[model samples]
Target: MTAINFAVIGYGGMGSYHIHNIMPNENERIHVVGTYDISGERQKISSQHKHKIYHSLEEVLTDETIEAVLIATPNDSHKDLAIQALKVGKHVVCEKPVTMNVEELDEVLKVAKETGQTFMVHQNRRWDPDFLITRELYKKQQIGELFQIESRVQGANGIPGDWRHELKHGGGMLLDWGVHLLDQLLFLVDSRIEKVSADLSYILGDEVDNGFITYIIFENGIRAIIEVGTTNYTKLPRWYLKGTQGTAVIQDWDLSGEMIVDSGKKNIQAPKPIQAGVGLTKTMAPPSEEATETVALPKITAEYDTFYKNFYKVVREQAEPVVKNEEVRQVMVLIEEIFKAAKR
Candidate 1:
């Protein structure tokens, strides 16, 4: 296997995470040569991990041995770093929320085309096990023709860092967590989005939103609610999907959940109507026990190529990328539409 030498341009939380998760276990075909970060502290930290520290971005770009660059910096810097790397004839793997806006991503795509470099975004959630399970459920109709999907992630920690609280850095809950949720939806649903409505929350009173709720309607008769909140004292289930014949819920990252579907068994007896506060009703009565069944969500059978593996294959002209530039561009466009809808 020919190893592709890779350089990381940021040493922040996600940058370090990429090293821990992707770099070490990569097949002999990939390696993390070193890293470049303007932060001296981050440089010191990288040294502790046995990774060399580059003096500057230019130095890393000029090195012929390095074949790819990973941009894990703030949202605003993704486009510039990506373009610069591509111009130097290096493939790039940019973090999610590829750029602050679709136009910026357009500029990066132009550079990638001009240089013939393989450019892909790290929309890693596309490979998450929980999401994979949910996608399988939707695609296979395990719950029976899903029509409504609600996805959310909540935290009480508020905004995590300095750059995330400012608008200029492209800081907002929508751009941060929003990108992941929206990307997942776009990947799972094949229909075009017919409408989008959103409301951004400012409970923390920062210049940027702390969280948001986005409602998307797809042409295939699917309605999705993607939400992220920092002010919630209690979190909702990670996933709640409704279908014509049954419903499913995934409570958390642990994939703890179940599906309940009608069993099509006739009731042996009629339900005894219970009185409400002022009236008796049978319409809201629970289904007979024999009429439904609860089952574990079927395990999903899918595998994802690591980000670097795909990068190498694409650069070698051996295969197409899992994260194509056009799909990423559409995600950015949807994000813009979401922002517009929230502001209206």
Candidate 2:
């Protein structure tokens, strides 16, 4: 199969990541022919990296060799840039928080339909190993029917970089990290969200949220608590889940965690209660060791390359995208709801 030529717009962190790390390992299904960024400094960096740098976006758009454009620009510019690329008959691979809101995404989706171009967002966390392992457990019910899911990502760094601190660029933890965690939850649950409530933190005194916590109730009776923090020096488990039989926790990005399931063999003595500051209680005691078995996390094969591979398939073979526009739109809807709930 001929490699699909792709031009990366916005030669910043994520753009360079795709160019240096992702594209080099794509098995030749896609090629980055050139790149364009509004900042001359970024263009200079791209050139120094041996990539052809387009002086203007128009030049990249007019290039017949470029079949697609990857938009790693700010969230606010996604809709306009995506629409323009699609209009020029180029397939689009956009970064997360597809647009500022559902309405904006709808406009781009409409143009995609009219132009007969394939569009996909880079909700790449869907490929994260920790998430994949968790998803596997959810599907296999390894811990029994999951009733609660707790997902979080916390960093003590506060919000880094310049543009992310500005409201005009769709800057905030919600639009930034919130989308990834929320999207992963929505993907894992596979049920309609019945209700939602959220609180956005402004601890850093920015116009946008520095962090947020959202509670979601799924139609299937599953409850999800998704949170993102930029000020947490002491972080919580990356993934925690509760189910009928037992529980599972993925402690961090290292995929270090345990799944403890009821052994169901019986005849085990109860956990001995320990004296507390005020009193002793058996209710808060840990389960007897014989009553439950701690198991290692399910092994998950890495599939990061599938995102671009799926995009190529969609562009050339008319296959459905891995990260569909409809799914991304649902995440946008949820983001809006989170904002409203936070305000309240």
TM-score of every model? Answer: 0.95, 0.98
Which stretches of model 1 miss by more than 4 angstroms?
24-26, 267-272, 275-281, 301-305
Each prediction's RMSD over C-alphas, in Å, is: 1.8, 1.1
Candidate topping lDDT: 2
**Can you list the residue pairs that collide in candidate 1?**
none
Q: Write the residue-wise lDDT of candidate 1 on 203-320 in tens digits.
A: 8999999999999999999999999999889999999999998999999988899999988776456666778779997777776787779989878754555666777777775598
Task: Give the per-residue lDDT of model 2 (tens digit) for 1-344.
Answer: 78999999999999999988776444888899889999998999899978899998899899999999999999899999999999999989999889999999999999999999999999999999999999999999999999999999999999889989999999999999999998899888889989999999999999889999999999999999999999999999999999998899999999999999999976888789978769998889888878999999999898668888888889889888889788888899999999999888
**Clashes within 3 Å, all models in order:** 0, 0
Badly placed stretches (over 4 Å) of model 2 are 24-26
The residue pairs in collision within model 2 are none
